[model samples]
Target: MKLDARSAARILRDPGALRVILLHGDDTGLVRERARTAALAVAPDLDDPFRVAVLDRDAPERLEEEVFALSLTGGRRVVWVRDATDAMTAPLKHCLGQASDTLVIIEAPGLTARSRLRTLVEGHAEAAAIACYPEEGRALEASIRQMLAAEEIRIDPDALSWFAGLLGPDRAATRGEVEKLALYAGRGGQLSLDDVRACIGDAAGVSLEDAAFAATAGDRAAADTAIERALAEGTSPIAIARSLLSHLHRLRRARLAMDSGQSRTDAMRALRPPVFFKRTEAFGQALSLWTADRLMDAAEQTQSLELDCKQTGAPDLTLCRRHIARLAGTAMMLRRDR
Candidate 1:
């Protein structure tokens, strides 16, 4: 069965009826978060080796075996597959068709409508597919409220709107920001716009908004300086790279809208978490420099660099710096050509 975002939380709370739950989407963070939530629903003790088994896409054949195996401790069992792909479709289909008590959750990247894996899960009577996209509009506000309420924190309506506007596309990042605000406000205290700015503004490399703006706007010196400051202040290279990718994605959207005959001003105004007023001109200049196709290419390169930084043998900070420097150089060249 196909699950919409509104019904997803309710279904996740009691996923016992479903044998296989497939969480696939472009938002990797949301996919992983939902997968963990579902796993914990079945196997509360995630750390227990006997109850929870984590596998990768390579071991699709082992899925059925793991599902059929009786739990050593005699309670509910969970078998989670990470980075699932089409290659595992056959085994998953066979496994989902059989009767089993174990909860099988597959975390996959975004799948096409015609994808066999997506079709199998969505079409099967015993399975369900939950799409994990970035939340926006009313949905985004509701999520913010829910997360903040969990911490017993309250915010002024205006403050809540401002804070929500600053949130990134990644759910994990959004959670982190809310948690930071909650901690700052303390229990039962109300947050104001001032508090939001104080806690979030220039809080190290965590908020790479400034650096990202600089990089994309062809301010090579400012971008280089900001990146160096962030790294010096202990910001992870992967985090910075992700921020850059998010910014580029926004630019791509604006460019696409313009290609479709919308005015640049209108396109920028329509952006979710709307562009900050201070950086409006820089953002416009970025649109002029990076076309939709070039933005896509830059995004791919940044993602690859982030993956490399995560490798054990890699110098993450150094690799991140190199990536930013290269982008800065490209930005400069693009500007000269224009």
Candidate 2:
């Protein structure tokens, strides 16, 4: 049996008495989502310990015994095995044969149509297979609209068209971006075309903003490369400064929005330039270590540095490089302070 992510939720709630439920997908998010569903469904009471058994596919030798043990354990038991490679096929098959009432959720990537595992699961009466792939076109748009609706946000068709172009194909990434757009709208508003443009801007702005984030996160190697590339493409020092300022401003706004009753997804949308949806978690991680005050201070410092670069006879490239390095170090320093 095959199912998509939407159907997985329903399956979890009323998962029939299958001896084994194999949840496999190429997309990491789908596999994890399904596995999580299985885990939670079998052990809805999180306090219960012995009801769930987790194993790695690499350790399939132990899986059969675990299957036998869990099948006899009280209520529904889950045996979750991750990273099922070809070498473990025999052991997995043995375990599947022995598994009685236990729900065996296996997470595997790189399984082709002709793969042995695929054949085994499809043939097994007790097992079900699910494919998790990147969304496209109408499917992608529908998901975006659904997520926005959840936050009480509406986007005009024009804005939705532009918004779709700016998002990544991954489900998590798509969900993340819409969340940013929604929160940016706040309560009772439609996401406009202008909002989408301002949030992600053109390709150049996207690259610069992503580079600035890399710098702020202490990835100096990536920061150096991204900064150099932007500079080579005629991105002005003032423009780079303004971009960082925009990022800082939004980080501050996102922090404030989060402090209010809004969710992080909403807070991200509330941000000025709108941090990419995929980056919300990183921004959240950044929040605990730094504050709006600190981010504003960094921006002010960058402004001063920019002024110094303008007033000096120093080489423009050299001065720009120095300031970007400093912006990159700000988060590290703030993290140390805490």
Candidate 3:
């Protein structure tokens, strides 16, 4: 059956008689983490080759055999199938309804609801499909708060709201940021708005946002400064590109709202995280400068640049700089036309 978040988490701690556990979603980090949790519940040492079997997509005949095969160590075993897909349906199907102490864990990151593997697992009584999407809004805030609370730390409401926006979509990345905050606060401490800014403002996420805003507002020097700092701080150029893409996507939303007769301020207000107060003026400028079509083109350009950055021998930093220059130049041209 398909498991809710609570049920899925509970199962990882105590998976009784479950033949196959499918963790699928866009949040690959969460999926991998949960998979390891569930597997560790069965086999205490997942690194032990005798008790755990890790398989890739196009693997040998070990999958079905590993599912039912008794471990040499004489304990419950774990079979981890990474990057699973609809193609894995038949292999996993054969394991269902059979009596075995082995647990089959599948990590499928991009499976849709109509996916055959998902349908099959949810249909079975002895199997489960768990979705691991990224947390957002109140959910994200609560998660950060709960995590810190466990560490005996408290974050002020405003700081929590701002901190939530700094987190990325990846669950592991979000947890890393939370851990940083926890360490910053120490035990039995509180995080205020100023503290949050001091801790995370210099982070790559914020720096990337700074670069993105500078580029979109036609501030070439500022964009270059932020971009160089981000790269020098060990952030990959692709991450910088994605940050730009995210900014453009946000602009696309606001532009659509403006197209529907909402004022730019209204469109900004409609944003979930709201424009960070510091970026409010530049945000407004970008909104005013770019038409909806121009924002679409810039978003596409950034997306392609991200893919290009992945190519071997590519000058990723140089390419990223050029892309930022283009964005700034375009914004300038739009401003002149206005």
Candidate 4:
């Protein structure tokens, strides 16, 4: 069965009804979070030796054997497979056919309608396919409210909207920021626009945003400083690269608008989550150097950098810094050519 966002919560409550659950989507953080929820529901103590079995890239060839094996403690067990791909379809399909008390949860990336694994799971009567795409519009707002409500905190409408804009597509990061805000507000305390600004403004997100803006504007020194600050704060290189990709995408859109005869000022003003007033000038500078085509190229490079960061044995932080520096240099050369 296919599960929508609204119905996903049901799985956490009673996952046993479904023998196999496939959580797959572009929003990996959400996939992992939901997977964690399902696992915790089955095995309250995650560290329990017998109840939980986590399989990663190094999982054995006969994964079904692991799934069908009896639990050491004689209770329900959660057999979780992380980073599942089409390569594991055979074992997963085999496991789905046989009946067992074990709740098999597989977390995977976004799959197409033609994906063999997705087709297999979705076709099964005892299996469920849950898509964990990033929530937006009312869904995003609802999530923010639900999270805050859990901490017994209330947020001003304007503040909620502003906070929502600051969040990326990652559910884990969003939850972390909300949790930080909740800790700051305490239980039953109300959050205001000022409070949200003060708390999130100093976060690594702001620095990362600064780094993106600086790199795109060709301000190498400023970009380097912002990137260093963000890295020192424990931000992952992949996260930084993702932020740059988003910024480049926005710049590409704005540049395209300009190509369509809109003034740069007008195009920037029309951007969603409207460019912050303080960064308006920097954004304009970036537009001047990064044309639509160049922005697209930069986006591709950023994506490549993100992938490299995820690879084993990759020097993620250094590669991220080098990429940002290269972008900054390109921006400078473009500016000089103009």
Candidate 5:
């Protein structure tokens, strides 16, 4: 019942007569969205009180009652439990033990992997558990394109990459930004870099992305300025570390493609989320400078930076700044030698 992305999509739509479906993860936006999808699958009209029931957290005992209740309207019933916690595990376990056609969709965002509810549902044959986390890399880029396309809008490739960075770890916020941008672009209008800046450009996400790329491209001053701007904008140290790790992992993938004998142009083209068009030349230079092994090393360093940032009383900003400086120096030395 442990669901990855592909299987999760299938299950959300069909659910295959599952009595209970649990959606849990750190990305509350994704969890909520998926929960809504699951609910709508069974009960199309959430407003219909008889067909769809929302469980009140204050009364966890109502879960079983809601699930067992038959619809007077003569269709499948859906019970939505929002802001679910471990306290509901016992109640959920009880409901899943019974026989009912009602679909119980649980939204337990930020649940730990080993949480009792997840363990129970994932282990159960009649129940399924889906972990909804934030999309990243290609997945995120594809989602952005899909959203824009849905609105009959097109974004320039470089602008798409920049806007992707500005999007989110939160699907809700991403949707909001996309909606705002779509409104700005209107129906047949195309989006440019200028358009992106004009709408939803104040986000610190792009600054963090800039810091990572600048550090890897040996632009120390640009890297410093980006890092400072991101910090000034209140970007968390851990978030910056995660951004650096994302860039390193991306480079590692591109390096792997090259090592497989693909031409540099083909390899870059094959990159997930595709490198921003403006960074193409620098990305190619970085590929030449950073071997696969070096990219892996950089990823490890970025991981360590995240760990350090999590420690109590750690000088997270200082540590993150120093890490970027070291990366910039490494990029410079590698470029000089190459």
Candidate 6:
């Protein structure tokens, strides 16, 4: 049977006799969390020398033997295989055949309809194949609400939606961010949009990232405000400089791709989302004027700014602002030169 991540409660309530559950996903954190939860449900004591086996995929042929040993122990045992791949096919099949009332949990990378391992688990009478993909749209919105509720943290619907969107692609990161935000909010309190914005959205790390995007797009005003916001929110200057350098380094590569006859669409396909959309227009405008050399120059300037922020005793915020101003100025000159 295939299971949804959120439906674990319902599924676990009535686990099948096979007791062999394979929880797989790109999100290893979530996969491990589920496996841990399930294992504890069966064997609450981890240090009791009980019937519980946690096998890393890197382990040798010991996994198959471990499964068999744990199963025959008579007591209900849970064996979870982490970082599983195609190499575990033979071992997994062998264990499944001799489950002996033991629960075997396997975590693999994200699987598709064509995945052979997924097919095997789904086809089994007693086994379940749970697919754990990054949630989005309604699924993500619902998950954010559910996760907050679990932590006894209430969020307004609007704030919930905002966090859901902000947390794109990484469920584990989202969970951690929510936990931090909840801690910041304190006990017996609800988290507001301002809390979300303050803790997660407008955080120094997040702001620095935004500033880099703004700078790359030649939006000096936005970049300046983002830097100021980051600093005001207690973001370290060195961290902001490092983030800026990283963004510029990526931008330089995208610009080079454009220079190499790759169309904007193709280049955008290669670039990560939001970054691609945010800079698509600016990059197009930039391509009309700035040569690869100019972009490389900007990248080098970013590196220099990073080094200066780290090595020099100069105030970090001022150094970053000055470097940003110079970069914007250079971009303006390049734009005019076109």
TM-scores for all candidates?
Answer: 0.65, 0.52, 0.68, 0.65, 0.71, 0.59
**Candidate 2 wrong stretches, greater than 4 Å:** 3-13, 45-48, 70-75, 182-190, 196-205, 208-338
Query: Across residues 156-256, which tens digit of lDDT does each residue of candidate 2 receive?
Result: 77677546644443455556566677777886778777787676564444656666777676566767887787777566565566566656666777777
lDDT of 3: 0.85
Against the reference, the lDDT scores of all candidates come to 0.82, 0.68, 0.85, 0.85, 0.85, 0.67
Candidate 6: stretches off by over 4 Å:
4-9, 12-16, 70-75, 110-113, 201-205, 208-338
Q: Which candidate has the highest TM-score of all? A: 5
lDDT of 4: 0.85
Q: After superposing candidate 5, which stretches have Cα over 4 Å from the reference? A: 56-58, 72-74, 192-194, 209-238, 245-300, 307-338
Candidate 5 lDDT, tens digit per residue, 209-237? 78888889898999999999998987778
Error of 2 at 322 (Å): 30
Q: Across residues 1-338, which tens digit of lDDT does each residue of candidate 6 receive?
A: 77665566556545647566777775666676677767777777755455877778787377776665643445677777878776676766776776367677788865557777777888887788876765666787787777667767788765665455445345666677778877877766698766777777544566776676666656689778888887786655655655665566556666678878887557656753224344466555545545667667777777777677666466767888887777666666666665
| Residue 232 error, candidate 4, Å | 9.1
Can you write out model 4's per-residue Cα lDDT over 185-280, one digit (the tens) per residue?
A: 999989987788788888887888899999999999999999999899877786787778878988999999999999999999887656777899
lDDT of 6 at 12: 59
Tens digit per residue, CA lDDT, model 1, 1-338:
99988678987878967888999876787889899989888888999988999999889889889988889997889999999889879988787777888889999975777889999999987888999986755677788888888878888876776566446457877788788888998887788767887888866533476678878888878887888887776666766776787788889999999999999999999886577677899899889888889999999999998889768789887887777778778788899998
Question: Higher lDDT: candidate 1 or 3?
Answer: 3
Q: Give the lowest summed-lDDT range of ten residues in model 6.
A: 271-280
Error of 4 at 83 (Å): 0.9
lDDT of 1: 0.82
Residue 259 error, candidate 4, Å: 23
